[model samples]
Target: MSIEIESEDVIRLILQFLKENQLEHTASVLEDETLVTLNTVESRDTFTKDIAQGRWDTVLKQVSHLKIPPRKLMDLYEQVIIELVEMKEHSAARTLLRQTEPMFLLKQHHPERYLRLEHLLSRSLFDPKDAYASGMTRDKRRQIIAQALGSEVAVAPPSRLMTLLEQCAQWQHQQGILSSDADFDVFQTTATVESKEDADALANEIYCTIKFPGKNAYAECSLFSPNGQYFVTGSVDGFIEVWNHSNGKLRKDLNYQAEDNLMAMDESVISLGFNSTSELLVSGSTDGKIAIWKTQSGFCQRRFSPAHSQGVTSVCFNRQGTEVLSGSYDKTVKIHGVRSGKSLKKFTGHASFVNTVLYVKDDTCVLSGGSDGTIKMWDVAEEACLYTINPAMNSSAALAVQSILSVPLITDQVLVCNKSNRLALMTMDGKVTKTFSHGKEKGADFISAAASPHGELIYAIAEDSAVYCFSVASGSLLGETKISDSELVGISSHPLSNIVACNDDQGHVYCISSK
Candidate 1:
């Protein structure tokens, strides 16, 4: 058993004694002389630093003070035990697993992991590393774990007080208290300023809008290029168009197929995705046809229809961009070679239409959500459904997952949006860690959702024509903006900016930017 003592507590106690002895000035002097900070280490940066340095003890010392969930707490203990095992201190590791309160609970909750640890105790030195290694280093693994745990720890944004003061000063100046136009420091007591910029960092109004109307031109899906250079939308009219992300200008010149802007496919485009470089885009169609287009030239690169009895609902490229993963209305997920134009693997299990699909867990697994109100994780090589998450079992009944967005930089998590009134951040193993609600009580169905470039925020467009922005770390609703008086749907976040793209049923796409 171990205990933590805050060193600052002793410093504070001395200061308190001084103040009680009626030596306020001396107490202030002593505070400055010692240069003891109250508790800045509770900040997310410090906690993450401790984790990165393999100081799991320091992190665990702060766990009770912070609001880390139980599962995350177990992760820290697991890290400690794994490290001890790696150091070849099997006795110490076994002691932790058997004697520690947290590990005792972990064994009861995660028997398989406990069993695996027991097996590791008997395996060779190199054997235990397999559970955590895959061309990844110790530092990188710690970094990933620290990042995942950092969100659960409460930390004020760096310089938050100063930023809020500046914003308040701006608001006061805009209200005519500070009248001078000359630039000056916001902290200055006597300076008067009139800056024409707003302090709100979230988009409140539409910045740029695009209107397109033709035969079956309703946009079914949209995606922003990973480079933040282009925003592309797939339409029911069988046409796909690329637009300048900043200006919303349609590039008709890129299409080499027809002078009249010939369609990308003969059937309705249902889903769209861009490769890591944004150079190539894949679109799935209602006729089960999949096509790849070169983004820069806007020319069709490859087209094929195979292995699906119905329309393709979603398509995404693996990290290598060499193969495509797709889900379809036929209630199946399939992988196809980008160059070979042949079906590579098929994962069949969903009892209803598959709504979304993506390769997760370093592309070793395929994760898909279906209209059957279930999310399934499949092993790519074995072609077996490893785990299934049912919405009803998770306390949200009658909800079908409409879409899934991968949380940026957080490898093991994804944002699952449902048709009912909730969206959740879930683990690849089917654990819902955080759930955000929409249209509460009366219930509003989310049409499409997207995460901010860094996955710090979530944006979901509901059938009510309003877009809701949420804080991913805190699971709080940040802001809500009505995009159209009509029906607004489909969301795609810019890869590099504070901009997000969404479209209405009338084929009118709107780009919203920071206010």
Candidate 2:
């Protein structure tokens, strides 16, 4: 097999390589032939020449034209003025001080630096080295300006050796030969241990606590938008509330009605899931109805009444969000088209209520976990069970799988929660890789489980109103957070942050953060 490389991409790579290696002539020739002038090269050259030759006026003019950040530009201005002071060009430095925006900004934000520069202008016969306390040489200041401009304009800096090493590491990572968790920070060389530690620490804090509106009914399920800005909760009173998760503001309230009266019991939303892009939300209700809503408008765009014979326990959207999968207490899983609002396919294998459903293997298969102590993988196109997995039985009590989550950043592995206090990380083939148990001391019974955005940690809410954290790599108990006094019902993790949200049976929602 041969790889097809785009001509533009190849040209970009070669030009970048030549420029980094200082082969200016070769890079110029390639640029001319390809008619592709790099976005940063021309501006960088002009800035470099102006700074090196002490062309203060020209440098200021170019700085105004470039899209340099305010802070960086201020630093550049300070360096240039210091250079002028060292050279005893007081008149030139004064002109820059009055004319440049950066100098004025520095005066407003960093008055100390500005006052020092002003004091240097009063010196008549001072040593050049003593003009600025920093003692940064003229050549060093020029280099700093060059690097800042290159970075601001998206130009690759002069570090050919480091660049080559990074390329090798990237290739190794792509080939699965380099473990991402390796000791050496090949990909993130500039990241410090403190930053990583801070990130890991964010997994332990409760940042936001949101209380639902209903006095008697509590949230049964909750889901975060794929972008993590918003979250929706389904309540026992058949009301779905959308919230701005960052600030705990109620965005919309979607109420279900039964002939003008508020619907309860079978109409209660038991499970909710967001589509891949977060544009739509699919909800499964106890009344065997599946509804799709426009996330922005909170309007039910499509509804499938009597989608199942009994309560719909779990609902999920396919990768495209064009289809929805739902598991029901009716003992079956059904797939429905979002546009047509018609049942497209149904799989029947579980001996008990199907609690959770998800798309697997590029959405070609469906994975469902039932109270019958088994998981069944069904072929979407064939409409048949492809395989069944019975996890290792640890007790004589009937095994009722409560929830299933695809392990974040992991392939063919899922986190499964059962009626008992234990959670299992198992492969699609049903092999248990690790088991996390909530010791009897806590008296915590698993209600649901969620994996962190990066799959490094697994979070579970138990009967004791506490959230338990487990390390996915070792299945060790990392920590636990007591979120409420009422029983916790549902939990979800932000897609891109170390934030987790859990709702309790008392209409309270707690947003836990690692920070």
Best-matching candidate per lDDT: 2
lDDT of 1 by residue, 1-515 (tens): 11234676566556555555688788768767877522323367888999999986677676644445678767777877788888898898888788877778789999988887777777767453555657867777788779878876554445444555678667445422343454656466334323433212455568788777774467777888775556788887888877665566675545443345444787888899899888899999998889988877666788876547789999999999999999999998999998899999999888889999978888999889988889999999998999888854345465778888787766788888878667888887778888887546553578778877557788898878889988887888889898887787688887645678888888788889886
TM-score of 1: 0.59
Task: Please report how far candidate 2 places residue 183 from its true position, in Å.
Answer: 22
Clashes of 2: 5
C-alpha lDDT of candidate 1 relative to the true structure: 0.76
lDDT of 2 by residue, 213-276 (tens): 6688778888887755457788988877776565676653333221223222347899888887
Off by over 4 Å in 1: 1-201, 252-263, 392-396
Q: Rate the local accuracy (lDDT) of all candidates.
A: 0.76, 0.76
Candidate 2: residue 380 lDDT (0-100): 98
True-vs-predicted CA distance for residue 420, candidate 1, Å: 2.2
- Which 10 successive residues of model 1 have the least lDDT summed? 191-200
Error of 2 at 287 (Å): 0.5
- Report each candidate's C-alpha RMSD, comma-separated, in the order given: 24.8, 15.9
